[model samples]
Target: MRKDRKNTHLKCCIMEISGRITKDAVTAKVSNDREVVNFSIAINDSYRPKGAEELKKIVTYIDCSYWMGSKMAQWLKKGTVVELFGRIGLNVYNNAEGKALGSLTFHTSNIKILVFPKTENSSSLPAVQKKNTDQDTPDDLPF
Candidate 1:
């Protein structure tokens, strides 16, 4: 978290999280006809306690909103693994039964798609493309 000069409150709370999209992203229009992309991601983690024979698995879901552009919603499909950089926030509210509940939210500034979900027709898994090293370099060099 980045604080202001006075340190009264946080100016920016930038954080990076990598997770899989829980569902397809949704775009909604707000005041003044502005649009926002909303989505949720599930982060999976596991830990082994001391003197434990098994690992305990945990899953945390965080709601994310992107105000930069709504066009990116098309590519933020379900099961897409992505790395998000943004401000992290927590919303604490009281439930009807007087229980305190807290929810995590991320105001996304940038997104990087890590992996796309497999399609029915595809037999092999998708992978990031690497540069071909077999190609010869041109002799016309400025260096």
Candidate 2:
């Protein structure tokens, strides 16, 4: 008997996460003469057990590598919240003694900044002066 071939293509696994940056992004040059930005995000989860009065918070750290460019590294500062979409992967490497080590990694394809850290002088900008006029302006305008 022959088997059916309706859908032979494997499904892709994409991961999406939103969290705050644990630290500033770092750029590194690979062997292929390409630069990549590496950073980590902290995702906070909270849950209360059945009939519990206190909230329990759990933080998960995700290691991410962005292949877009090093320009994005400047925006990924510590305490900045970001949303990322990418594919999850496991990086496997051998130790000095030939021991295997595996780590959870995320290869980010898209990233968006949600919030940025506030600066001390951000709200101290001088106010701009506007032109004063007594005439009323028309409200009708053409598209």
Which candidate achieves the best TM-score against the true structure?
Answer: 1
Give the lDDT of residue 87 in candidate 2.
82
Off by over 4 Å in 2: 1-11, 92-101, 121-143
**Candidate 1 lDDT tens digits, 75-117:** 8888889999998877666666666666788889999999888
Q: Judge candidate 2 at residue 85 and give its lDDT.
A: 92
Q: Model 2, 102: alpha-carbon shift in Å?
A: 4.0
Candidate 2 per-residue lDDT over residues 58-82, each given as its tens digit? 9988899999878889788888899
Clashes of 1: 0
Off by over 4 Å in 1: 1-12, 121-143
- Model 2 superposed RMSD (Cα): 10.8
TM-scores of all predicted structures: 0.76, 0.68
Question: Which residue pairs collide in model 1, if any?
Answer: none
lDDT, model 2: 0.79
